[model samples]
Target: MADKCHMCLLGLIILCPLLTGMNGAETTHVFCSSGENVHLPCNIALSGCTSTTWNYNRHSSAVEMVSGGKKKNDIERHERLSLGSDCSLNIKNTKEDYGSYSCIQYVNGQQQGTDAHVHLHVLHGQCFCKSHV
Candidate 1:
């Protein structure tokens, strides 16, 4: 019984930080196929995306994809990106879109709350075809 309790406590200590950011924001994992469209949720309730900003990072410096609910025209993949009604970041025809995305909300030029982090994992799907002889 003591061993089980200790193991549980150890697990919590090891996993808690990974589950939540330092600011106590929960991280969500989104998995999608390589060539499919994907939605990275903001997980925040808001009337509009006017105060939302989405940043993406893939093993390097973060890039701002959307600012104040508007897509950044200068971004590399801006053509394939759109902001959903619910402030979710939508990426169309996702091929190399796997990365860490963060949604931040600001009001009056100040951050409102904790940022929502999302880790996107893109999997290469395989097709199996059978021949009828």
Candidate 2:
């Protein structure tokens, strides 16, 4: 009996860190051309998400992109904005859309939350001023 208890304690000690690591927020960088479409991954596997929002540094605050199974008015909203069933955000890439974004996940009747951080970089054309000799 003592040996079984000892083994259980050892198992907890080894798995504690791994379990905690699963809850950590993941950060990723995405680069897209100024006139293309780019998809930002969010809740790829989480279910029962009561609400979800996407916050961008370019905006004043978090915008309710998806709520109550619908999309709300957001400052970042564009004609090509698309929300996937998995909660991924698809945006028509533009220079104005280049910024750090956070996908917030909310569960019903829960206070704690999880999120994914993404940094968007828009590739734009370069112009050079040339002077003829």
Query: Who wins the TM-score comparison?
Result: 1
Q: Per-residue lDDT tens digits of candidate 2, residues 1-133? A: 5456445445544554454334365556565546767787774436643466666665555455565434566544646676777877778645567776777765664523566776665645431111110
Q: After superposition, how far is residue 25 of candidate 2 from its true place, in Å?
A: 4.9
lDDT of each: 0.77, 0.58
| Candidate 1 local distance difference test against the native | 0.77
**TM-score of each model, paired residue for residue:** 0.76, 0.60
Model 2: number of backbone collisions? 0
For model 1, residues 14-126, the per-residue Cα lDDT tens digits are 66457656556567766655778787889873788999999999888899999999999998899999999999998998888888899999999999778888877665653
Deviation from native of the Cα of residue 114 in model 1, angstroms: 0.5
- Candidate 2 Cα RMSD after full superposition onto the native fold (Å): 17.4
Report the lDDT of model 2 for residue 127. Answer: 19
lDDT of 1 at 122: 68
**Candidate no. 2 TM-score:** 0.60
